[model samples]
Target chain A: MVSLRTKGSFLKLYSWLPILILYISVLNEFDFNYLNLEYFSFNFPFILIFFFTLKDFKHFDYILVFIAGLFNDTVVGLPLGISSLSYILICTATAYLRNITIRPNPVKDWFYFLFIISLINSLNYTILTLFFSFDLILMSYLVNTFFTFSFYIIFVSLFKYYLKGLND
Target chain B: MASSRDDFIIAIRSAFLKKSTQQKFSLLTLVFFSLFIIILSSLDFKVIRYSKAVINELVYRSSFIVSVPENFIKDSFIQVKDYTNFFNKYKKNISELESLKSNYVSNEITEYENRELKELINDYVSSSNKILAKIIVDHDSPFLKSIIINKGSKDNIKIGTNIYDQSYLVGRVIELNYKTSRVLLLSDLNSNVPVTIAPQNIQAIVTGSGVDSGKIKYIKSGLSGQLIDDSIVYTSGTGAIFKSGVPIGKLKFFEENSTNEYKVEFYSDFSQLKYVFAEIITQTSILPTTQESNENSVEKNNPLDAKLKILEDELNIIEESNKKFQKENENLKSEINNLNYKVLNLNNKISSQNKTIDQFNLDTDELKFLRLNLTYGHKCRKSLFNNKGFIVGSAGYKDCVLRKGKIDG
Candidate 1:
């Protein structure tokens, strides 16, 4: 009976790993920024949010994701709620896609992610520049979106492995 | 087409309002909440500001805690990389250190001179205290280059306080919390510094290139031709945003599309920063306590006025030196007077001693004459046979006494 209880607890922890990782990513800013690569950065939170929310993972709570966004904004020194808005918009887009889809395709989801991130980045750039009077490089945003979109497929495969383990 | 339109509406509504089993709020409510926060944060409300500060305090601490493992890994990686090139780096550093050590003494003397000159030019003496602060978070964000340091208003770290890596200017504090502040690195897109290029002495504004370097902007036309690579760039202290003469970077020229472009490669690597110094500056009026109240009424605002003040100081120095020369001249005059008085006294003493010597010589001659008269006075007697003998005191009588009563022949 004790062994079964331990197994159950371990399973619960495993199931909640995605949200835990989300919080860590937001706080840690898990992008390999120290690599010192020129014009190299990707938003790991965006990729995580898009993939999990599109799959509609049970433990990936929207409220937690929103809070993560706020944390990200704080860490990145952006105006409050900017990252939250972007993350929520991603959730909203994924929800709309989920609602309209009869059959899901990873390629379609990936392209949709590219479009959503591009739009979100554009909106982010506009808001920061026009509203907050923040100086930003459009090229940096373009590169960020490109890198984030490119890294999504690779991370998605790993996330799939996690889901498979949970199901097993 | 009607069915498709209906489907689209239903899907949009579901995306906005629908909540999953484990979800706490619909996506639409969160979106609106996000918008509300953005608007509220922009407004300067005391409550919002204080709350944001509190949130920032919490978030920064949490972020530091969360970053420990990652920082350790990053540091270890860097250490390994450093080890791979340790010997070459050591050799280079040794040569660099030797040169830097040679320059260090002159640099300190110049710093002191600069401080004195600044004090003379301005009405206040600016005393700066540099307090060491650890970098709590340096994510090196591509969009906005900034770092969170473990010092803030509690540590007298106000907005615009200059941060430095060693002596090189890194950035300034832009946002301050209670125990943490955000420093906008010089490499940020929003960062603009007024700088003077050495060797050329050209004034220009350096704006970050949204990368690791800064681009020189707003130079006078035709001055770009005079700029050479590796020229030093330092803060001009214009607009009083940055302190004057703080080393920022060196100028590098790159060609883009057959056109010359210049960028400043910063002295401090923002990526490798672990600790920094935040300079807290306090200014006090330079006037003496006795004259402060009276001088306070006088205006010393413009450069011309400062020049006049400097001239007045120089005049005072010249007056002091002149006074010293007059005192020395008075001393020399008294010394000459004392020497002349001594010379006159010596002359009187010498004359008296000469008179004594003459009297002594006369007494000896008289004694010799008396002895000669006992023997030769009979022969030399004027009344008897010696009419040739004169009086004893006369020159002829003295010579006859010495000749033992002999005649003139």
Candidate 2:
């Protein structure tokens, strides 16, 4: 009976790992920036939000995701709510895609993710430049979008492994 | 077509309105809330500002706590890299330290003069207290190059407070919370500083290139031609945004596509900053009142005394150099005197040797005369029978002996 209770607590923590990782990513900004590679950055929160929201993960709360956006803005020194808006838009895009699809396909999902991230990045670039009068390099946003899109498949595979372990 | 349109509308509405069982808010509600927060953040409302400051205080602390492990890994990596080049860096630092030591006194003099000039121009005495602040978050974000320091309004850190790595200008504080402030680095695209390029004295604006360097802009036409590479760049204090004459970077000139490109390579590397100094300036107006007249009198005397002290220092330096030159001159004079004495001794020895040689020649001639007397002296003697003979003690007799008794006048 004691071992069973311990196992249940461990399972609960494991199930909430995505949101926990989301908060940590926003706070810590774990984007390999210390590598000092020029124009090399990817939005980890964007990928995490899109994937989990598309699958409709039980513990991945929309409110928590929005708060994570606020944390991201504080960390990155952006205007508040900008990242929150972007995250919510991603959640909406993934949600709409989830509702429309009858059968899931990873390749199709990958391409759609590319399209979605590209559109979001364009919107981000536009908003930052036009609204906030922020001086941002268009090439940096483009490169960031490209790298995030490329890395999605690899992270998705790992996320799939996590989900499989949860189901089992 | 109507059916397809209806299906699209249904999917869109579901995406916006539907919330999962565990979710507290729908996507549509979150979207509007984010928009509201964004607009609210832009406005200068006192309540919103206070709330934002509170949130910033909490978030910055949380971020600092969460970034500890990553910081450790990064610091370890940097330590390893630093160790690899430690010896070379030490050697370079030794050379730089020597040059800096030589320049230190002159630089102090220049600083004093500059302070006096600034006081004369501004009619106020501004005293700056530099508080050491630890960099809480240095993520090196590519979009906006900035760092969060662990000092803010509570520590008298204002919005445009000048941040520094040692004495070199790093950036200025852009956002100030209660205990944290964001410093916008000179490498950010939004950062622009008015600077004077040295040796040329040309004034221009330096804008960040969103990289580790800055671009020189707003230079007069044809003045760009006069710009030389490796010239110094420092703040001009124009617009009163930054303190004047603070060393910023070095001007690097390169030609691209037949056009000259100039970049200011900052002296302080933004990525490596772990701690910085935030200058808290307090200005005291020098306008004299009845109560402040005594203080004004003291202040007035201070500048004169300072000038006298500087002049005294200059005199001391000149005297020190003069003393060194005199000591060298005395040493050289003693060496020359010793050389002259040795030459005189040599001349005396040579004269004595020449005299000895003359004496040896005279002795050999006398011996020859004696040897000849045994054989030919009898025929050349005064009592001798031959009339062609020379006198016995005459100079002609000695000459005849040297000539082997051939008596010729």
Expressed as tens digits, the lDDT of each residue in A87-125 for candidate 1 is 999999999999999899999999999999999999999
Task: Please give the TM-score for the first chain of candidate 2.
Answer: 0.97
Worst 10 residues of 2 chain A by lDDT: A29-38
Candidate 1 stretches with Cα past 4 Å from truth are B287-313, B316-409
Contacts from the true interface found in each model, as a fraction, amount to 0.85, 0.78
Q: Name the candidate that leads on DockQ.
A: 2
Cα error, residue B211 of model 1, in Å, equals: 1.3
Q: What is candidate 1's lDDT per residue for B242-298, written digit by digit as tens? A: 999999999998999999888899999888899999999988976556564456346
Question: Residue B368 CA error for candidate 2 (Å)?
Answer: 25
Task: State the local distance difference test value for candidate 2.
Answer: 0.90
Q: Model 2: what TM-score?
A: 0.81
- Residue-wise C-alpha lDDT for candidate 2, range B280-344, written one tens digit per residue: 99999766678656655665767766446546767899899999999999999999999999999
